[model samples]
Target: MATDPVCKMNVEPAKAAAKVDYNGQLYYFCSESCHKAFTEAPQKYAGAAPPPHSSHQHGHR
Candidate 1:
């Protein structure tokens, strides 16, 4: 399984919607949107740290 850099979604390499090779590393995307986003700015996400997981509650009534 690979994490989609753009949205941090878990994706299966074989079943990925799209894949791209960047800087000698292969990246997989859950959707074309993510693929497009990553290709547009690979550097922005390639070296970016994954967003920390949090359980903050959303405001709801």
Candidate 2:
């Protein structure tokens, strides 16, 4: 599982609605809206550190 940087939701990479690569790292999003927002200005959501990359972490629904 991965953390959706824009909305902070737990998402499975294999089941993610969207995915983006930034600075050699992979990011997952729960919805297209969040993906769009992140693409428009990733810095706004990513902040100082990128979300942790995980395979099966739990997150808010």
Top-TM-score candidate index: 1
Candidate 2 Cα outliers beyond 4 Å, as residue runs:
48-61
**Reference-based lDDT, residue 6, model 1:** 93
Report the error of model 2 at residue 44, Å: 1.4
lDDT (Cα atoms) of all candidates against the true structure: 0.87, 0.85
Model 2 CA RMSD to the hidden true structure, in angstroms: 9.0
What does candidate 1 score on TM? 0.78
Can you write out model 1's per-residue Cα lDDT over 3-22, one digit (the tens) per residue?
99999999999999999999
In model 1, the worst 10-residue window by lDDT is: 50-59
> By TM-score, how accurate is candidate 2?
0.75
* Candidate 1: pairs in clash: none
TM-score of each: 0.78, 0.75
Model 1 alpha-carbon miss at residue 33, Å: 0.3
Clashes of each: 0, 2
